[model samples]
Target chain A: MTDATGSEAGTAWRRIADELEAAIGRGDYQEGATLPSSLALAERYGVHRHTVRQAFRHLADRGLVTVSRGRGTQVTAPRFPYRIGRRVSMRTNFGAAGISVAGSMLGAEIVAGEAEACAALRLEEGAPLWQVEALSLAGGIPVSTGVHLLPVARFPEFDRVFVESGSSITAAFKACGIPDYVRLSTRLSARIASEREALLLKIEPGAAVMVSKAVDALPDLTPIHLIDGIFAGERMEMVVEPFGELPSPPAGESGA
Target chain B: MTDATGSEAGTAWRRIADELEAAIGRGDYQEGATLPSSLALAERYGVHRHTVRQAFRHLADRGLVTVSRGRGTQVTAPRFPYRIGRRVSMRTNFGAAGISVAGSMLGAEIVAGEAEACAALRLEEGAPLWQVEALSLAGGIPVSTGVHLLPVARFPEFDRVFVESGSSITAAFKACGIPDYVRLSTRLSARIASEREALLLKIEPGAAVMVSKAVDALPDLTPIHLIDGIFAGERMEMVVEPFGELPSPPAGESGA
Candidate 1:
């Protein structure tokens, strides 16, 4: 189970993990194959039972294995790359990774702006805006539910575009002459899901999900969109890249 | 739970959640105290029981409440401000937040550099370095455990300073004549815990933790420290700030 140049070392468990990983890679242990129990592996490797458990833990982290108490450890098939590179549309991201995107639009309507939404759009409170709520999916599995706001006066027919076309959000915005946008800021935190969200994401009540609030701006610095996305934490990761310097100032006038 | 402005036009559950949050702020519900059951809240707020449950979910995300099956929704005190400010010592950060630091040094030993460590430290594969493993605690709760590597040749009296001074690693390096260092880079990821780390962090095996690998460098571009820290995900946050601009090309290293 060693690598071609076997220099990696740890206690017995790590060695066993490495060997198991190699066997998985070599197809000796196919995806979904049940691995020997910790007791069995311990007996075979002549190590403590705890040592075998450690080996399984290492494999789990690498996405090579999953353990269920009653079912034991089983190989996990390699998952599609869930990349969070900023250069793609959210829709394109899932599509490129071979995941299906399927979700019913909850609602789309023009409304008087709420205080937070107005501030995010750089408009006065009560200004006209289009708000859209959608459940986003990957591989037909609900991953996030999001609400997006955009100034309706700036983008007339926003609701129609959302309703009639399956185009990317960026495309919809570009059609309104806001050709380019840069993400100005984002805030991330975690929280338990509501029953509705939990049902959508198919997780327990107390399971944590990532809450992301993002603001984007047009090239001329006009605020364009404010989005609140709740992501299933166990199924997702977020990547942030700070350009040239560290600690860019937080966004918004009050920095709230 | 009205907002200060007291305009409520959204869903019933949202307003209920807001009112409950306001009531908490008003000291109507003490921290750790169970809230009225969903039925009770629904009756008081004139909403459905499910709507009250939805309100509780909102409070949970704000970190103000926790809900369990047997234990109803309960108020929680504000979480510790896990400051993620860039470029602060671990001790300094925790100290500023009024948390004490304690450690049980798992081991401190001279180790031959592995290939990965050698590449990171720019040393020969067999070069000697001091590897120190410690379980660090805050508020008397173990929240992080880490391993640090320092070049043994540079800190000639490493063991003596670490043993005698009881100072932080940075201070110990300063005592050995290396007075300044800058963190070069950090890599971040997250994964569920293993049996060993789970025991150390006092969490279940599937609980997530934050993982960071950082390299610190001295003025002459020599590596000073290589640190790998794992923080309890629910208990800590990391802030990073980049400053100024990237270094320009070296005169001696002209490129075509």
Candidate 2:
């Protein structure tokens, strides 16, 4: 009965969501725990089951709940373990962990590199660069959106090459005649996601996101790419092993 | 005077802050850009200058503005660079940046090691651990709060040592016959601050926080301590170097 009309239904669901949120915030529900069924919640709130479903969807978008086919609705858990260290292959790592990931190109454009990008790519300030925006999803769930920068002088028309290669950065690099690359450095911070970012990631507005600025370098330490990644913080954890086994760098070498 | 009484003053300041927030979100203001003077904002809002100050204070607590001496109120920029690599000493790094930092003990208790802590410390499930909570401030601004866990068998009365040693972790380690330790691994995630954490960090209720779970090990890779650090996300950037020079582990040796 609460779903009298369009706007009325909207307001009713939001009210239910707010009450549920307050209950969750007060520890009335625990993480990895399931919520009552939609029919049960509808009866409790004296609303249509569709309205309860809408409320659940809103909470899921906020990263507070997970909706699965057989599992029903459960509190969100950090399920993805992202590895960050020397010699990390996202495809291999997440694949081994039974997570299927896919990348799609959002757009491509040539722009002047600013301070953060220029510093990461070891280019002069305001240098021309090819910027490509890509979104990656795991298990059909949007996980990260990355802004990739490549020096225009080094990789001309790289953006086209990226799209032609199905938005795979590695494929684009190989087409550019680079066999391999290594992550040189990364700087991470966290903040509330902007409106555009939330839309792209399918997360709620103002949701917390982990931002990483990373530089990829060639074998000789020549910087080739600068990547700014925005990760949905609720579903991922970045793992680092400081003493991981890796080859030693040559003595007295400075990265370009 | 619009600010007639206590609750009236509260409502007046919040209204101004909400309007300014909308302006900032629309990109009317830029990062690292100074806003108009308090007097100017007061004239625009038709409120007292004191009311404007309260609005600015509210925004600052939400990580939107910076009110520093002589600098007036500029947008907040990430100023603290936290270095994370093979060897990291918070005191040494922040001190090198000319920022004064102090650590204060919040509380200590004996608790059972949860899954995260047990795995980090390589302890049996449900093992006893000493959990010491401490807060660190940089230039009198709260930056991080850390929960440190140590084996109850090895670090008896370690909480007492921590308190007597001016809440210095290094001093406590030395007193417990640990000459040195190094971080072996770190796992990081980000989320909205809880009620208690927001109060301790002096941030808004739902502000983002970067959580780091780090394990410090002895020279032989025996896990010595587990630290869970909650960092105020707005003012910090965590820097990581993949190729930092460090000694390699001995052949075929596995961490404990």
Q: What TM-score against the true fold does each predicted structure earn?
A: 0.69, 0.70
- CA shift at A146, candidate 2, in angstroms? 2.4
User: Across residues A96-200, which tens digit of lDDT does each residue of candidate 1 receive?
Assistant: 667667665677767677555676576787898877777777787777787788887777787667545453577677777766776555445445566677887
For model 2, the superposed segments whose C-alpha errors exceed 4 Å read: A1-74, A245-256, B1-74, B245-256
- lDDT of residue B29 for candidate 2: 76
Question: For residues B17-135, could you state the per-residue lDDT of candidate 2 as single tens digits?
Answer: 76776666656777778988899999998889999988887676445676655778878764487878766667766889798878888878776665445655767857898878889
Q: After superposition, how far is residue A110 of candidate 2 from its true place, in Å?
A: 1.1
Query: Could you tell me how far off, in angstroms, the CA of residue B142 lies in candidate 2 after the best superposition?
Result: 0.8
List DockQ, one per candidate, in order.
0.10, 0.22
The DockQ of predicted model 2 stands at 0.22
lDDT by candidate, in order shown: 0.65, 0.75
Estimate, for each residue in A13-63, the C-alpha lDDT of model 2 and write its tens digit: 978876776666656777788989999999998999999988887676445
